[model samples]
Target: MEKTNVEKLYEWLNEAVMTINMHEDAPYLDNLAMAINVLFYHDTQNLNNDIVKKKLQTALENIQLEQYDKMEKSKAVQLAILTGMKQSTQQQHMMTPETVSLLTGYLASKLMAGHEKIRIFDPVSGTGSLLCTVIDQLQNPVEAYASEVDPTLIQLANGSANLLEKEIEFFHQDSLRPLLLDPVDLVVADLPVGYYPDDVTAAAYHLKSDEGHSYSHHLLIEQSINYVKEAGYLIFVIPNFLFDSDQADKLRGYLLEHAHIIGLLQLPETAFKSKNNAKSILILQKKSEKSKEPKQPLLVNLPSFKNARAMEDIMNQINTWFTGFKQN
Candidate 1:
């Protein structure tokens, strides 16, 4: 029987996942590249069975065999398994396709134009989704940087970048500290919520200490602001409760004192996988040459959302902004 394209795509994606799961030294980047490739070639039919095996076989063979030659299988396998299984540990932290689309859409809109060399950074980069999306969507080649406290996730992000032919400086470091690198023009980060660190005993780890005064999102945001230039833009996706809490006024005041609040996009409850319904986008800008001090504070409310439609609209809006910049 001739298999439909949908069936072939299903088979491909499944096989790719299965193969990576089995290979001891399979680079995490290769899996991302394979997944992305499958996403591009996917159809409704192949999402099920046939084409997957062929795709998996090809992806597996395409890995750099020499890279694995010096590596130890046990360690590699442990890392691979840890990463493959990370999403299954806590259902709450897993990101949905809608979230992925939103991240990519924002990047597409904001940084697509090659106007003046643009550098992008994500401090709490998870599995490199936002960083990769930004890299993949940019019209100009960007010097991309990302930091993930989780070593396994860091490996996955680095591996994905290698496979995609995307260059990014990814570090397994505490995002709370001063950035060891140069200032970025734009910063986009999905701040961490309640999630355990991969390492429990590391004293310097952010999640390790739930001190009386630290590990708060407000503090995290304050630290992140240090990484941006005086007039750079920061797009932060945060929990909804953050805007209504007692700390909200203080954080808002702090942000207003330091930066310009350009836009805010509130998200639907289902935008996150958690039962906690807190999702919102804060668009902040540092003092720029084109900036104006307004008499009144500005607030923008977003329209109701249907994931697919909203994502498309957001992407279009972003493209429009970039296109306008390109024209001017």
Candidate 2:
């Protein structure tokens, strides 16, 4: 699509976001609904005006009727960031499908059985989908910390958190920077892909590319490892392209050295229907004092699905793995 045309879509979506911002109930839903409508209209071959209209009506009806207040400001921000994301291709800053899967899977794994005082942090939180899911799935994350370089996204994330009634500390900074002085028990994040950030700005500190070069993703992995205390677990969703890449190998080695490689799930392509790309989830836990040697990684390649069920199954498996580990 032409940039101008995309801009028009942005205008329409942003207007919807403004409307949502004004609504105290389901603030993000308005923008989301508008986005769906735009997609349906633009989908051409798959266009369904009737379906789109029905969906919009349903969304409108579902939004809780509530008074607007200062608290609903974040929802407005979410709409704005989403508007930027739709056109971020020009900026070479696309949030890939694999990243979303990894974030969702991480939540599923941690929140399955539920717990008290659960602390979660997304060092590279985007629109805060993962964090939002975490808050909604489990009762409440006692403490949630998230950081993103983009001010727009940070605002959106914060807005989503408010809408969901999830308490969180939103940080608008690069995840590569030094983090909390104390470590948390669980860390869930997705490292960005190569190309856009450039080598100088990439945050891969714990990885080495196949050619023996470093990438930004390495930085994210290393920080995650360092930010979690002993017995703490870190789950990362990485691109397949990085698996055999030199940096991928370096990442694997670094993680193995500092932690126990518990499980490696090769995710299906369909896990990310919004975009095309095969991804994998790497589950690492700091070597417990009880164990001396590193254990082999349990690699599981999830089956592909044409619908959301595939994601649900993947989430189930992740939770099961965590449950089985606690039992063992």
* Error in Å for residue 227 of model 2: 0.7
Candidate 1 lDDT for residue 257? 75
Candidate 2: deviation at residue 233, Å? 0.9
Worst lDDT 10-window in candidate 2: 38-47
lDDT of 1 by residue, 164-273 (tens): 45678887887766568787878877777643342333244322334333334565677666777877777777777777765466666777677877556666555555
Task: Count steric clashes of candidate 1.
Answer: 20
List the candidates' TM-scores in order.
Answer: 0.65, 0.65
Error of 1 at 20 (Å): 7.5
Deviation from native of the Cα of residue 51 in model 2, angstroms: 34
Cα lDDT tens digits for candidate 2, 72-181: 43334344555556645434234435345445555444533445566677888876766665555555445778888875456555655654456788878777667654
The TM-score, computed over Cα atoms with residue i paired to residue i, of candidate 1 is 0.65
